[model samples]
Target chain A: MSTPFLKKDKTGICLKLHTALYGHDAIEQFRGAYGDGLTFVRRGAYWILSFADALEEDVVDSLDSLLVLSRNRKK
Target chain B: MKKFIKADGWVKVPVQTKAYPLQAIYSAGYVFMDKAYLYLDLEAKDKVVVWLKPKAKADLDKLAMEFCQELLNYAHYFSSLKVNAESTKLLLQRALFSAAPSMVKEAEEKEIQDLIKELEQEEEKENRKPVKKGKK
Candidate 1:
């Protein structure tokens, strides 16, 4: 049998499954299957992110703008 | 029966490279998505192919993420200069095994074990089949 997905090396950013807004339940279900590594949160509209560390301050700010731009484009 | 000669059929070619490291990030992402939905081709080399047959949602998702990273990495690496086909191939293999080395290794190990188990099960089943009786 294949070895279950376990934390390999606790170094780099932990793999996170990010999804669109409507994908919350799907992300949550995945969290249940994979463990607590998954997180649901809001970005521009909404996003699911998992990472070893929060992005750099500038990156966060840029992402925020990008999210807003994306939201605007949708409408 | 009549003897006949057969000719080889045409087949789509596959490309094997990590990603070109000089394209727009968003456009690169789209290329990855397209390839995932279709096939990965090596346009430089007789178009050799490489792809993963996702067995589960998790597997598919992970592969998508890896593709994203490869595109990002490729763009980052080559934005300043031109990359040859040889270097491109190496970069892609690195991307493949680098994204989730542990996961890929685990999967390969599991696949080997599963194959062994399957062979054993087939052997057991063969031993259990009833033999046909000849006419009395």
Candidate 2:
């Protein structure tokens, strides 16, 4: 809600999060929750989430926030 | 304040492993897990690197200082725990064993009664069996 994720202000197309930071469990949690419409690719230490369709900036931010929430819940 | 490496949207805080143990670092990292995105890596055999990326715009210097302080706090805690571990374990064992004797006695009594009943039933069955007539 504070601001958009750093992706040139167009963060809906694709998303990248360092796996070491948020962890693989977080991505799996995201996949179980919001991954039906997204493509997931694990490239080394990063998880790249490609959207299936064009989404609003706020929606993208919400998904990112969800990813963070999943990370917290993973503990 | 130690020199916090300035970077784009993130700061690198490095600590010497010789100064603080890995457990201390991990404990500090856990405290900051919800507050920031932490990526811990070993730069060398003796250097621990922590990359702290805040969710919002904040002072990187302050974050780094806080992390260091947390690490120190945990290190002290662990040391104190180690110092008192023997007495703590002894006290906990005494607390648990204080109630265990009665519980164990009751369980053993029940088991012995069940065994005695089974033996009595088997003996009764044997007594009730008709003795086969043997050649005189």
Best of the candidates, DockQ: 2
Error of 1 at B92 (Å): 10
Q: Ten-residue segment with the worst summed lDDT in candidate 2 chain A?
A: A1-10
Measured with C-alpha atoms, the lDDT of residue B27 in candidate 2 is 72
- lDDT digits (tens) for residues B93-136 of candidate 2: 67776768785677679999999999999999999999999999
The CA lDDT at B26 in model 1 is: 34
Off by over 4 Å in 2: A1-23, A44-75, B15-26, B33-48, B53-58, B78-87, B103-136
Tens-digit lDDT track of model 1 for B1-136: 2222111211122223344421333334344443332222233433223233232243444554565466556576566445476787878877987897986788789999999999999999999999999899
Complex DockQ per candidate: 0.02, 0.17
Report model 2's interface C-alpha RMSD after superposition on the true interface residues. 7.2
Chain A TM-score across all models, in listed order: 0.32, 0.65
Clash count for candidate 1 is 11
Model 1 lDDT per residue over A1-75, tens place: 011111223331322222331234544444465444334445543343443333323222223223222223331
Candidate 1: list runs displaced more than 4 Å: A1-75, B1-96
TM-score of each: 0.20, 0.51
Candidate 1 is graded, for docking, as incorrect
Best by TM-score: 2
Error of 1 at B116 (Å): 1.1
